[model samples]
Target chain A: MSATLDDLDRRLLWALQDDLPLRERPFAVLAARLGVNEDEVLQRLRRYLAEGIVTRFGPFFQVERMGGAFCLAAMAVPEERFEEVAATVGAFPQVAHNYRREHALNMWFVLAATRPEGIAEVAWAIEDAVSLRVWLFPKEREYFVRLRLRP
Target chain B: MNGEALFVPDERDRALMLATQAGLPLEARPYHALAERLGWAPEEVFARLARLRAAGVIRRIAAAPNHYALGYVANGMSVWDVEDERVDEIGRWLAEQGEVSHCYRRPRALPLWRYNLFAMFHARERSEVERAVAAAAVRLAARFPGAVRAHEVLFSSRILKKTGVRLDF
Candidate 1:
């Protein structure tokens, strides 16, 4: 989490969390909306990016809509070689997210791909590359997937 | 068949998808900017975007918030082992909750793991997440009269790698 944010910082974050304006000067427009100077808003955002407060600051796309695919898969990797397996799995451009969880199948990852075949191709590559059968658990339905962490 | 097979995006749509996926150039008249770069009229780009959106190709034209910056420090991956037939009904109900950010039905790894439904809840404290999970359990109980078999919340130990999308796939 970001270190103590002031009132103005919070306001800027809350306001920018929505779709940014599609204009010549978005930050300027946003600053106007937030009642702050354009340079200050841009500087704050730059600082946030540098500080890792903001992982990404831009338009977000729904990859699935573009015929891209994603899935959550897990592996019961050997404790000794967990790091090795995780590194192998994480190397793929298709694997957008990889996490170490607490369970029998402790290693979990989300495979993001541009093509349908790309998903299985990457999954198979990982299976042979790491000597572990990757259990593919593709999403059957997405009930909801919107997140807004209020400041 | 998947949406890809059902709706084949043309060369122009592909260009639009690639452009939009990269985070619309942070500028005013982003659509116009996109058009200028794509060598099409602004209206053409706007119309294409609208069509893509309507087709569920672009779920939304919106901002992706940085949760950590906003104080949602704790992340919980709550999984449930509910009756297979009743999974969707309960999953949708739980997804409607304020706490759940994402909910889905995935194939359960049997015998060893039985959880078939997954919902990720984020908050400042683990207790807050537990309360949300408890409420979900209650929702399951209400709908099917105590049919939820088991559930667990797997808080991520570490985020090895996370980037929401890979457009260059």
Candidate 2:
């Protein structure tokens, strides 16, 4: 997958992770820093977004800061019933990211809602839909860490 | 963090969020494009965005690359059962490690689940992730000894869904 990316593309990917300049021509500023033309930068970014190389490309909002809540929930489903449960859980708009992990508690997902109470409400609704106990693990404290993946 | 009042997005803010949640327009003047779409002045759009950022509602205007597409195929959620008293200290320590992307102190479900400290590790290969976690475990044991108990790494087998936070206004 990475073989399709060139040196410029890799650098652009790394650079895009940082905050973009809030100027009239943000792409121009980025292009300058990357030693590329504005058109080239925009073209590559469009391609990246279209190709699924970049999942999202805009403001990263912290729901907590906005008085929203995010909770990590998990459930252990029978192997035969895993797909059904996953589909049911994934149907909820509050489910931001759901993953099938290798553990007794296999179905893990992150729930986000506008209000703190809303998280539990969604979890309960999912529980009702799936007939499985949803264990919510709200973070008591978050340790800060910056992640930058080198391409 | 919960003590602070929530920053409720007004109608305009909600409209702006809905418009830009997918992404900023790839144009010479993205904000202007947004303003035109929302039928607001460009300056108003800029001011609102700046205010939202200052209020911490918007973490940053950035790009989130797909880790798997970037060749980071191995992603592991490392959970540990550390002493309650030292969990914070250990979590802070783990957060400083390059391999640890996110570290948090969460409640442990007794009996079945005993992990309170969670840290995510990502690498190009599963073996590399395992080795990194092993090295971190050894170091953690050396530093905290008895405080560190059982640990497990749950590798993600599949992404059932991954649409980041979509709030219906």
Candidate lDDT scores, in order, read 0.76, 0.90
Model 2 chain A TM-score equals 0.95
Each candidate's DockQ: 0.51, 0.80
TM-scores, all models, native as reference:
0.86, 0.97
lDDT tens per residue, model 2, B37-139? 9999999899999988887889899988888889888999999999999998999999998988889999999988999999999999889899999999999
Residue B133's lDDT in candidate 1: 85
lDDT by residue (tens digit), candidate 1, B42-134: 878877777766676665555455565567767789998888778888888888888889999888776776888899999878788888888
Candidate 2 chain B least-lDDT 10 residues? B1-10
Assign candidate 2 its CAPRI class. Answer: medium
Error of 1 at B10 (Å): 2.6
lDDT by residue (A81-104, candidate 2, tens digit) is 998999988889989889999999
Considering summed lDDT, which 10 consecutive residues are worst modelled in model 2 chain A? A1-10
Pairs with backbone N, CA or C atoms under 3 Å apart (clashes), candidate 2: none
True contacts kept of each: 0.60, 0.88
